[model samples]
Target: MTTDSGTRTPIRWGVLATGRIAESFASDLALVDGNELAAVGSRSPEAARTFAERFGGSRAHGSYEELAADPDVDVIYVATPHSRHLEDVMMCFEAGKAVLCEKALTMNLADAEKLVAEARSRGLFFAEAMWMRANPNIRRIAELSADGTLGTIGQVRAQLGFVGPAATARLWDPMLGASGLLDVGIYPLTFAHLILGEPVSITAGGTLSDQGIDVNGGATMTYASGAVASIAWTQVAHSDNRASVAGDVGLIEVPARFHHPTMFTHWHDDQLDTISEPVTGRGYAHEIEEVAACLRAGKTESALLPLDDTVAIMGQIETILDQLGVAAR
Candidate 1:
């Protein structure tokens, strides 16, 4: 079930970084048929070798350059940090490889726009790896919301927070584009946007760290139709991590850990209906499928996880952080 050019053939995935997220992606990719882990590249030779051995990659390259130029690799998964995404993705695209970069696709909107434009000009398939967007339950919920299952959508609320180790590099480092707003808060923001579309007006305010990183923050977005969304996120303390969509007729409640929730409740007046959905293979496979499907079909972007949506999401993050007086570096 492969083609001559190889890019349209069964996917041979190359990972650009040997990080925790990269390892998770490779683990889930194994569940996908018609796909193979071709290679892994890392700045550290040992890290690349170790990742390939564990993740079933056939070859390990000590440098990213080698992986990018690999003819055997049809696509490269850029699993670097928020700050490094643009640089890493560009490397793959310059080498003519399709890319699936992780969420918070870039540090700011400017970089996101550049990446999108580059992908288009190069005629390469590109997608932001926002796995939640690919979830079946989330998709169903989006459909219901659009079809008026919840009536006139008035207000949506979502929050995600957890305790993190103080010494973790990503959490404490400003250069890594560290922000509670970008890292975890983007989930609440995107969840609202997916259901409600872009907001007409955005007003946000929150506290930032002494080092100028957003540790805890909140945002309020209003649509032209009078609907509103309230979002919250923090790494300083533990919260319920809940979400709800309220409308004139009813509301849908996504319980704890709403971003990756498995169950949700539909409330219509006195009636409460609980719906549960099963997930497949750590929830990463769905996003992978979207990428693989696009590449196979000669598509340059995914309808489910479009680059425009990714860029818009980052723009929203910039607006919120700016109003909150937090410098999004």
Candidate 2:
């Protein structure tokens, strides 16, 4: 077991993409005390150089291999599209470097399992950057639910959706592994998983594009405890993005973006109560700190976003896709 050391030594990071998500992660890492943006790699040297200059990092390389081979980098952040996560993370793993991969861990369950197995076999840190799982608000929800504040948790309903224009955009692009389900559905699925655990029975239906990705979908999950959750996600319509948990005695409703909600409401037998909290920096810093903490302690995975849970969530997504007749290639 790895223990937290009082002496804080910065964990050097090698950024593996120059996309918006990568930039967001870099900005968030700046707010963490014990993380260093050691290097950056991009398909284009000019892009990598420009990103490095803007982010205040010295080593910018043109190829992923160069960045992965850098001995000074303690970990690599795989910020590429969902389809590339397997290749990017596997490269880093083969190079003997730890990885902090972006969410939707891979295109599918098989690749995700391979990455997890490799990390476990090598005793290196690996985590899906499901930042919401590390948020204070979500943590509080978990604590309250576990403590029985919701009273036997009978049902959960969550939706995350946004309107997108066409197949040209990343959200609609099949080559990029972009779709409503994988891009935004993970939020609701993860939220349900947090409160209800893995579902015993999963049923889903959706509309898929000619390109073969889910454009809009809804999943119904029934847990062994008789708790049921309904989750919906879409790129063609805008949704409330709210989540609710109803129990025998009371209910709780989370505000928009429930996964990273700004406030939540609790109703116990007609008395209504609302709890609000502020979060720091785009809210990605918390997960960055978590990865750093886990890596520094020599841990192979995060307690908040365990590998098994990630795999299970991906499997659920796979089932949903199977039911929808959409393949995530």
lDDT of every model, 2 decimals = 0.88, 0.88
Candidate 1 lDDT over 122-145, as tens digits, reads 999999889989987788778878
**With candidate 2 superimposed using the best TM-score fit, by how many Å does residue 318's alpha carbon deviate from the native?**
0.8
Query: Per-residue alpha-carbon lDDT of model 2 for 1-329, expressed as tens digits?
Result: 22386566688899999999999989988988878899999999999999999997779999999999998898999989988899889899999998989888988888888889999999888999999998888888777777887789999999999888664467877888887888999999999999999999999998988888898999999999999999999988889999998888878889887878767888987799987766668888889888877886778888987999999999998888889988645
RMSD of each: 2.0, 2.3
Q: Candidate 1's error at 298, in angstroms?
A: 0.8
Looking at model 2, report the run of 10 residues with the lowest lDDT sum.
1-10
Misplaced by over 4 Å in model 1 are: 1-9
Q: Measure candidate 1: CA RMSD.
A: 2.0
Best by TM-score: 1
Off by over 4 Å in 2: 1-7
- Give the clashing residue pairs of candidate 1, or none: none
